[model samples]
Target: MPKAKKSQAKPKTKKAPQKLRQQVAALPVRLSEGGQIEVLLVTSRDSRRWIIPKGWPMKGKKRHEAAAIEAEEEAGVLGTIQDKALGHYRYSKQQADGREIGCRVAVYALNVTEELADWAEKGQRQMQWVRSEIAADLVQEPELSLLLRKIGPP
Candidate 1:
């Protein structure tokens, strides 16, 4: 019998790129008695690191509006959100299912009108009002630190 010929296999195909996603964040701010600017920060549910209130975009609401809502829910703040975004930062979000997905966050300034005594997630998170320089030192993300350092009028 003749020797059998070998068959060649096709190479594996490349994977498609992961879909990009975005979220809205609120940087709550207020003027102190000494006429200094202050930025509000909240702790993350998992790591307890200082961060702004942020969450997934809401349907039918403007990005700024959604950011304001996140501020209220996560940090017990009510404020006027700037119509435009202050800036943006990117990070990998860790989902409950253990998936770390890349995400870009649009940050809006929320001129704090009031601070509620109680709000959603109040017990689960800690909130603080701090100076911009101190806030810059506390946040983990460099881009976010830059944003915090620059937190001022416009």
Candidate 2:
């Protein structure tokens, strides 16, 4: 029998969470007619988890501006995004190869000015405008939950 050749697969290396990848999230909010704090959340593309609009860094744009871009693409929100970040949260993001990467998200408040009748991701995901307290409860990430709960009406 001929000897089998060695496999060419590369060894897997684990990335350190301490050097967590940076991400930006848009916390789209608006005051309801009742003067209550209502936050906009969109379902994740694959997992369908309740999450704020977030994405990787954008070229040339500032962090918060990139976050605003994510909000527009994911939730159909047009608004004023605060220059300062409200807070940060860490979560494990599932990768294509069944690995979870650590992501540190800077949350920026977006005071919604207009919600489009139709936006980029209108049909792929479900968007909801719920009370801030309710948003805190719906998210699975504990740190995100705390962040949302602590965020006052803006």
Candidate 3:
């Protein structure tokens, strides 16, 4: 009888680039007054969910600068850095053509100083200031939720 032939193993293939790996900046603004803390929340344009202001980094702006810019554009609010950083979170955003993109967002704590009546990029589904604990619960992303808990009530 002929000897059995040895089997050969195939090499692993490289993964394709995921659609969602874009760099973005986000600010978590918590407003405090008279011992009460509130968080700013913005409803996304698609009206599918609520989230904080965030966007892609601009040509020359640093991440924090981009975060401030996004806040102004999305929520009509001007803010200053309050603490080092709340933390980071990852989520998926859907594109126009229905493609799901993975996103990693770095979040910083900001103290809001002003709220402009007009926004550069209008059409946010909604905007509101909710209590910190409620705001944390309202957000759907797990990582963001965890960050909020870590920051704790302000």
- Going through the candidates in the order shown, the clash numbers are 0, 0, 2
The reply for model 3, stretches above 4 Å from the true place, is 1-3, 9-22, 28-32, 82-84, 152-154
Candidate 3, poorest ten consecutive residues by summed lDDT: 22-31
Please write out the lDDT profile of model 2 over residues 1-154, one tens digit for every residue. 9999988899898865366899999999999999999999999999999999999989999999999999999999899999999999999999989988889999999999988888888899988999989999999999999998888878
Candidate rank order under lDDT:
2, 1, 3
- Could you estimate the TM-score for every candidate? 0.87, 0.88, 0.82
Judged by lDDT against the true structure, how good is candidate 2? 0.93
Model 2 segments more than 4 A misplaced: 1-18
> How would you encode candidate 3's per-residue C-alpha lDDT over 10-105 as one tens digit per residue?
988899877556455455456466666777888888854778888887899777777888888888888785434467788988889997889988
Model 1: per-residue Cα lDDT over 20-134, one tens digit each: 6999999999988888888998999998988999999999999999999999999899978998999999888888999999889999999998999999888999888888889
TM-score for candidate 2: 0.88
Best prediction by lDDT:
2
Pairs that collide, model 1:
none
Cα distance off (Å), candidate 1, residue 150: 1.6
Report the error of model 3 at residue 39, Å.
Answer: 0.6
